[model samples]
Target: MNISWEEIELYLRHTFVTARESKKNVKRVIVKLEDDGFYGLGEAAPSPRYSESVETVKNFLNEFNKLISENMSLYTTLQMLNNLNGNYSAKSAVDIALYDLHTKKLNLPLWQYFGLTSDKIINTSFTIGIDTTENIERKLDEAHEFKVLKIKLGCEDDIKIIQTIRRYTDKPLRIDVNEGWKNLNKAIELIKYLEDNNIELIEQPLPSEMLYENNRLREQTTIPIFADENCKTFEDLILVKDYFDGINIKLSKCGGIFNAYLMIQVARYLNLKIMLGCMIESSIGISAAAQLASMVDYIDLDGNLLINNDPYTGVICKEGELKLINEPGIGVMKIEK
Candidate 1:
């Protein structure tokens, strides 16, 4: 088997907003593994907020590919990859692509190979980035097709934003702070203020810049706090075990389906609420995560499908429910190299 990698530029149909920032573009690293003339692909979009550059991730992948291609088995490959820090998304993409090939070689559906057989579909929350109260309300009114609404709210004047959104609908709602809240005291205040109105949960309300403080903050909120940035890999799981009520796993963050599978088992044992999230990639990445969502507790894998301008295929987000294409080996059309 041989592995090859490429940096992909996926254009977002529109600017995506979060509490900490907004983006009007797309960038990704797609890892492709070829063996016996068959190919498997996985993608990850590197974010500057995570202090990652495309080249940094690519160079590391090059080394990983080089080392693994020298005749290392998957287990050995995993050990080498785990020894590195950061680059979780890059590693995840490569891991996913490898699994894609492995499953395809066996002529099996990925879910089956992973020992999952449920036809359970997950209702994903459509995310509305940090926007004006009026715009958020407008989007909320238009979001009749979704069952849940997840708004990004880690900034100044967050109270007004949550208050405005509450006035619009009483539906189940969640918020991703994106490490925007500066302190635990502030995050606690924000969660308490929004709890009764429409807040179902708060994610990463405290900043991840400080592990001790972030963990300390999670203890103060009654509404469950999910660790996103702080819980990138299972190894980091121990650091956040006491601080977070749950952990959000993004295929991009965990380095692919294989490692993500491992994380789920460990998280379940540790009693962590599992959430599956996504980056601004195409349907390919979303489908990979969707396959795992049915086995987890929360699903936030709608970022790609929710864009008004996604011109790819694989998964569908309708009626707030995530539906996979139901094809084998990720059910994706290969990106033309």
Candidate 2:
């Protein structure tokens, strides 16, 4: 088998403004591997907050390519990479690519391997980024086609934004504070307001590492709280089990599909809701998560699919919904080569 890696930049259609940040571009790695005439492809993204970079992942890919020659399987490939880099975005790229490679090699879809339901349409939430109430209202109007909306919050007036959106549409709403909330008092205040407006869930209003703070905050709210940055690995599970109502399993953050599934199993055992999420890549990466979305309780995959210049194809997301192709190897066609 031969392996190749390339980094590409993806531009968002509109400015993607989060609570603490705004991004105009997404940097991704495209992994290409060939065995005889058959081929497999995978994708991943790097964010400095997660300690990832193009040069870093490429260097890791070189090491991963050499390890594959030693006949390490996908499950152990993650273990091997973890032995090298201690679980970062580079590890996840190889982890997912190998899963795509494994399923394609056996000529079976990834969902079957994971025992995921074959749901053709996975409802997604269109994100309403942090901005002026008027900007959010305008975005909601433009995003009228979506049934579920996720509002990003970081300000003292976030509850007003939710209330403003409620006036536009009574659609199901999920708010992600991205650890922008300062303390339990303010978080509880915002939670009460959101619940009054019929918001479904709130994500990581407090910092990920604030186990005590988050647990205390969880006690004060009726709405579910889903942990993103906190639940990166299974070892962190016990610490957060009582703190969060759900977990957002991003394949990139947890290292790969193997660990992603492991986290889901643990979350299921704890009777916690599962949210399959992504770190903003093209359809190739989104489809990777789509293969897992059907098995989870919630999905937040509209990230990369909403971008204007996603350069690959394997899935279709229309108006805040996902439909993955039933083709072999994640159904992605490499655009550059």
Candidate 3:
């Protein structure tokens, strides 16, 4: 197998702000794997929140190249990833590429390989990043076609922000506090206000470490709470099953599709709902995540949609519904620059 990679910057259409930080653009590493004349593609959108960056991903890939050979199987590669420390995003890039290469060799779509169907896939939520009230209105207008909208909160003026958003439209809304809220009482109070509004769900209201606070807050609110930062891998799910109602599984954060696939089974056994998510990535990563959309309860795979320049095209989302293509593997094609 031949492995190669290059760093690319993706400009966001809007300033993507979360409680932790803000970003106008993001750096990503596009990884390629070639074996027996078949090529597979993947992307690594490393997040600083996870102590990962472009430099870290690149360094991990360099070490990764020395660990495997042409005779290694996909299972072997996945098992090897467990031995490596951290760098889930970097491991995810190689993990996705291997799955793509393996699936293509068998001439089967990724979902088909897992004995899943696209019919159960739900519409994704278009994110409205944290911005000024005026900018929020503009974002809302632009997302008119989308059936659901995810509002990013965690600022000092969260109530004012949601109020500003409610004035614009009454579309179904999901709130992502990004672990912004601190006090359990305060989170409970905010939940009351969100409940009166069109909020369908709340994500990470308190900090990731506040497991007891989250469980207490969950008991007070009727709305379901989905864990994002708190739930990174299958192991994290076990720890957070009693804390959150559902888990937001992002491939980059969880280490790849295979890991995410295993997570779905474990989450179900733990009686937790599943929400498939992604970073601010191109279609290569988003499409790879979408292949497992059929197994998730909610979809937040709109990372590619938020970007202005996506180098690859796959898994078209029309009015929020992700249309998974029938092509072999993860069904993505690079666009010529």
Report the candidate with higher lDDT, 1 versus 3.
3
- 1-337 in candidate 3: lDDT tens per residue? 8899999999999888988898899999999999999989988989888999999999999999988799888888879977798999998998899989999999998989999997764799999878888898899889998889999988888999889988888888989999999777878888988888877888889998998888888888789999999999778987888788988999999999989999999999999988899999999999999999988788898999999999899998887799988989899999997
Residue 263 displacement in candidate 3 (angstroms) = 0.5
lDDT of 3: 0.90
TM-score of each: 0.90, 0.92, 0.97
All candidates: CA RMSD in angstroms?
2.6, 2.1, 1.1
- Encode model 2's per-residue lDDT on 171-290: one tens digit a residue: 888888888988778777777767677678888888766778887777877889988878877777876788889988887787777778888888899988888888778877787878
Model 2 weakest lDDT span, ten residues long? 69-78
Q: Scored by CA lDDT, what does every candidate get?
A: 0.76, 0.77, 0.90
Model 1: CA > 4 A from native? 68-80, 83-85, 209-220, 306-311, 334-337
**Residue 300, model 3: Cα distance from true site in angstroms:** 0.4
lDDT of 1 by residue, 129-231 (tens): 7777677777777677888888888778688887787677778888888888887677667777876765667788767867677666656656788899888
Q: Rank order by lDDT, top first? A: 3, 2, 1
Error of 3 at 279 (Å): 0.5
